[model samples]
Target chain A: MDHGEKRLMDKNQESLFVRLIPFFERYGILLLILIMIAVLHLLQPDVFLSWRNVTNIFKQVSWQSMLALGVFMVIVTAGIDLSVGSIIMLSLMGLAIASKAGMPWYVVMLVAPAIGFLCGMFNGIGITLLRMPHPFIMTLGTLYIFRGIGNLISGGVPITGFAEQIRVIGNGKIKLDVFFGEGAREYIPTSLILMIVIFFIFWVFLNHTRIGKWIYAIGGNPGAARAAGINVDRILIVVYTLCGFLAGIGGLILAGRTNSAYPNAGLQSELDAIAAVIIGGASFFGGRGTVLGVFAGVMIMGILRNGLNLMNVSVFWQQVLIGSIIILAVYIDVLRRQLATRT
Target chain B: MSDNLVLEAKSVSKFFGTITALQNVDLHLNKGEVLGVVGDNGAGKSTLMKVLSGLYKPSEGSLFFDKEKVTLNSPRDSQNLGLEMVYQDLALAGNLPIGDNIFLGREPTRKVGPFNFLDHKKRKQLTEEHLAKLKINVKSADQKVEELSGGQRQAVAIARATAFNAKIVLMDEPTAALAVKEVGKVLDLILNLKKLGVSVIVISHRMDDIFTVCDRVMALFQGTNFAESELKNTSRDEVIGWIMGKKD
Candidate 1:
């Protein structure tokens, strides 16, 4: 190529790079996650690449994934549900008490989710009808209230002796015997399957449903949403309620996995779930995120913890690393938004 | 002409905790007429519009639409009665696509079994059709509102108001932030709405737009009707005098 032609091509490439900057900012987390996986595999190939360990990671993160999904919706509406962890603990406590009362296992399952829905409704009502200035304060208040109730009910002890059927919901695995030879079985945790199914349902809802669009619209600009004839208060209530309901489901899975419902179960879980959602790509300021992005986010956290554990990294160091990643994720989001506005 | 009046407000007053935003204001809008509302910053132009659009209920007095007495409790109530407002802020969700913003609350949906899903194809087609009919020069319906220029965002907001079959459209400072050329486009849009026989109540500080588009001008001075006259009968100086509380 001639010198002028080469310079012209270089200018075109430069412009193209500028154009792709926003795209990179958006999916950079996914890339970082892939790089982390590669690095972990390089560090401990035998342990990290094992299917058994991979499935274990998925099982470990499934309940947290559920909580993240719920938090994702709430964040998308420009709200936060700080009460999620407490709601989960409270729901599990209700399940434990019900099971101890000799209620049928199926009935307890139904009751647990019902308790969760009501708790969510309480948050919703407190914010919507009471006209709370911000959901942060509302949910934060409920967080303490619900946790206090949980502690009171459980008397600061664990509730055990759950039925085997109930236990299977968390610990059971679906084995693919047909696809593998003897002793080469692949097992998928039931909870993981449930999480995936819930994710799929929410993906369709957020993308294809009117309420989902309203959630984005409200989050993007609530004054506009109201002026456009949307019932902003109603949608906000629905979102917070759903967040609580999902937290209830997470509580049930936790109870099943441990075969007990401890008063302090799911403590500080809200932070992890919020971190996962933010790390996935949802903006803390709201009106931006995708369900797929959230799944990727949950996976990133799962992989990070698992990789660190495999490396025998100290728990303190893991906390520091995860905290740094959260700050990095939010900083990237801020930069992405700035680029978006500029373009 | 009086029989053709589409909306009439009689002695409407709104007070915010002893602060009278609007006091005993009387207004009238005729069919297919562009009525300009001119006022100073605190002259209660926006307050009056809010009452007409049902954002706030009047502290006292009643509204009449199509010669019948009525009450509007909310924006939805006004919208149901074929009245719509293009707020000064434009009220467009920046993150949403043009089509979605245009049909944010009133999206078309298709039912599958017991579930309802957005009919995105229909929405896009209708958005395109509306933009074309209104001659709004935007790239596509799928383009996000944030990506559009100021004039284009205003066009989308206007298109949204018109697409819902509003008989009376109230606009607040529609040309306040537009470039000179873009301001011309918005003025032309108001003319087109008039051609379609839609009544328009435009609140603006730009006297040129009022002269170019409004049929009759209403001036408010400190929340009261300072002057009301036909555009041809009133001059810019006279309107300015009314706004400045120098003449009534």
Candidate 2:
């Protein structure tokens, strides 16, 4: 009788552990971030846990997160924007031209995303009207075309001394440190605030809007969406345009932070955005991505980079690790799709 | 040109380059009627359905809706005339929920001054009402299409067509992929569509399905209309023979 009771207790304990495994699976990556932070804190006890370092990471990831979110939408439609990084350069040129022409800071900000919208619109038209087979081809061509255009126009020169408003936008901090008590000297970044606000907007746009659901539908089965009377061409155009628009916003932030518009800005940043989206539990197979998952992905990438830098890791090793993670994430996505279809 | 006729195809022919996919096929469906189209493989049943759905323009002939001479330039033109089609593939987004699939393109919206948002509450309520009317045994309106059985998916497709008040619903091979146990549920959904006063054109190869739910059966053999008659006047053996290219 005593043995039976003991066995029952053991069974109950096993069941509890089994239930916790799902939690681990769901948030195992998050746990990994914490472990990484712990290790980093141990390595750089003074600097890693400092508020300055933490805020710097947030500020750095703010613009890239915008790119990640934008690419997330494009990917949700089973499309890619290889030109996003290149578009950033193009938008930066637009920003420089507008500012140099003595335009208002707000106009300067508008100039970047506006150029992005047009470029994205062109990408959409090329993919749809040109009868291109896939977005991959269309975006690939524009990637080089945009970069070339930026270089031609800017002549490879960098423009600095943006308006005070723009500088604040990129690097200005709101003094919320007083809330932490006297002499805390902590200030929240404007870019970080803007990034979070945009994230909220994107979440609502994807989950609550009609076009958002249509995007998912098109990704899941374009033929079905077309059969259902959706204007598929228009939606694809909208997605590409939105991606371009967001990349422009990133450029705006970039200009503010560096106080300069350089032709080579955001070189290869599109790869980073793609990597972030893939790691965020989104599938390349389309119709399977979440904003929250992508936010986590952005955080993971940002934290990893920050941690590695504090450890004084080589830039090449960082690239190697990020590349490996991208492959691993995609492989996991493929396995997940296989498992989903089997049931 | 009777007032009772909802749709009529007058000697329709479809050619693919040098190959004749359909040759001079004539068909008609009445108000609140279930027409079963039967044929052997490569007999152009799909071609006929596509022509009717306006996915393919008939190479030679005219289409009439409500006895008015009309031309179907595209699927939108047909849909605008209260015509809807549920393809053999069902054309449903498996990742989406039932409500989203039911109202994919024509999602109703609640406009706030300048901004328009999907009226999700209204959508869910209508989806539930339609599913309830069809007596579909899905867990909820929010259930994803991938999670449903083949029968449930078929019911969802029919529900989508009927929800739009489509006067004519064209279905292609509704039961071809369904299991024996699930076939009856699909057939019952078709009956429910009929009971709702909706007209349906069901294309199938199964004689049992035809006799069970369809009021009339038409056969296509080698890209031509071979035979057509009321189900009561025809035997299953005769329809089977008609399917096998045996002439009477």
Which portions of model 2 show Cα errors greater than 4 Å? A1-45, A177-184, A331-343, B1-4, B13-24, B59-61
Clashing pairs in 1: none
Please list the C-alpha lDDT of all candidates, in the order they appear: 0.90, 0.89
lDDT of 2 at B244: 94
lDDT for each residue of candidate 1 in B1-248, tens digit (9 for 90 to 100): 99789999999999999899888999999999999999999999999999999989999989999989998988889999999898889999988999999998899999999999999999999999988888788767898898888888998899999998899999999999998889989899989999889999999998999999999999999988888999999899998888888874
Single out the weakest 10-residue window by summed lDDT for candidate 1 chain A: A176-185
Best by lDDT: 1
Superposed by TM-score, candidate 2 places the C-alpha of residue B223 at a distance from the truth, in angstroms, of: 4.2
**Model 2: pairs clashing at backbone N, Cα or C within 3 Å:** none
Off by over 4 Å in 1: A1-28, B2-4, B10-26, B56-62, B179-181, B222-224
